[model samples]
Target chain A: MNLKAVYIHIGWFQMSVTNLIIVIGMVVLFGLALTLPFPGNSKGNKKGKGRK
Target chain B: MSIMQEKEMWTSKLRKSWQKTLPVEKLLPDTQPAYVASWIYLFGVATLASLGVIIASGIVLAFEGASWYHYSNVGHFINSMHFWSVQFFFVFMVVHLWGKFWMAAWRGRRLLTWITGAVAFVASIATAFTGYLIQTNFDSQWISYEAKDGFNSVGIGSRFNVTNFGQMILLHVAFLPIVLGVITMIHVLMVRAKGVVPPIDAFNAELGERK
Candidate 1:
């Protein structure tokens, strides 16, 4: 049940495989959060809505 | 009028300032702007919730003694919760930071909010580093020695010895958390006062509509 942790190394830069995955996942999540429509939010549906 | 009576009390001045800046309604709002309807807004709350979990788990670990986690199963579980919650906290916080940066959250006179949030992030890193140093293991020993050089280069090594477990634990569990909590509270209050920053386009559009 033991596994050696993998790491990515590029000359002077190094990061654990798990951490690199986490970073990539966070970036993807941020993108989705920006693009995805929020539930029950009809603000985007309304025309001429500018924070009134 | 008597001299002492004529002068306003400092407490009254403080209360007035608080009332003017952040009344109950503003501090705890029932409604938010339509633009706040985004999943990105949840990251800030997620980071807060993760901090709560970390604090709760850490309190349990503290009651059992620091090294008890290495021996007792329950202690180990609690310690694991603390560890994972910290990871989640950092992840959520970093995502929140990224989202805020893209949103230009410091816009509309909210610069203090952004500054406080950034300060909290750095303070959290220091707290986490201290937590690592107090782990009482070879990993901690290695980390301390490796970190000592950096701290020394910054002229803080004498004051903040990474190898000193007692000093590190105190900073980790007490001082850093209090500082981080204060900064976080100020950041949240500023956000509540100013409201969430609108998107750049929406903000410009609002100004255009006004004009």
Candidate 2:
């Protein structure tokens, strides 16, 4: 095609590459963080007395 | 409460409630004035005032006809006023955002206000983009086509047409205002609920030493 179309294609490619990379990085980091368990005294069922 | 009861005019209730008790100022206490930073907070009201001017000027421009707004001196003046109001709206909004940001004003139970305001900012930007396109001028032509590429690249082009006056103008005048108004109301209500955040304790300590 023409030089203008080529330039448009190049610009779009660069923008998509940048935006997609950023979005992917954010998602991966978020997923990793989500999978992490919080370090704490895990006392859930321990709080209750046994039923009489 | 019934939906119909909730729909009653606020002032109607205000008049009805006058026999009971006056309103309390501590909906959120005045103790957190420093968080709002005095006169600078007026910038938020100024932004709202400019939005008022925009709507008023826009309605007049619409009444005069779009082509008339382009050529008639009066229409042009009204359009210019609307343009300047948008400038003011943007400036005041930025200042308010900055002032709130530096205060770390979202501390305490007030994070929701900050989040809603951030959403409002996004909506306002969308509103401004539509405002630019609706003029259909040289600037509009360039910005419209150029902006669509960014959208088309991202795959939102199927839903939103950047060049269509019907969509953009309706969005600018109707949809955005309703959303912004609702969000703004929520933002204000949350702020009133949570009260302003306390000033930095270190700053208070410094001031105590000065005394």
Best by lDDT: 1
Task: Quantify all predictions' global Cα lDDT against the true fold.
Answer: 0.87, 0.70
Q: Against the true structure, what is every candidate's RMSD?
A: 3.6, 15.0
Where does candidate 2 chain B have its weakest 10-residue lDDT segment? B28-37
Worst 10 residues of 1 chain B by lDDT: B202-211
* Shift of residue B22 alpha carbon in model 2, Å: 13
Q: Report the lDDT of model 2 for residue B29.
A: 44
Please identify model 1 stretches exceeding 4 Å from their true place: A43-52, B1-7, B203-211
lDDT of 1 at B107: 88
Per residue, candidate 1 scores C-alpha lDDT tens digits across B5-49 of: 535788877887888888887788667766778899999999999
After superposition of all CA atoms, the RMSD between model 1 and the true structure is 3.6
Model 1, position B193, has a per-residue lDDT of 77
Q: For every model shown, what is its TM-score relative to the native structure? A: 0.89, 0.64
Residue lDDT tens for model 2, A1-52: 1133212146446444444554565445434433455344334424323212
Candidate 2 per-residue lDDT over residues B67-126, each given as its tens digit: 677778988789899887987787677667866787788887678889998898888888
Docking class of 1: medium
Once superposed on the true structure, which residue ranges of model 2 sit more than 4 Å away at CA? Answer: A1-52, B1-37, B202-211
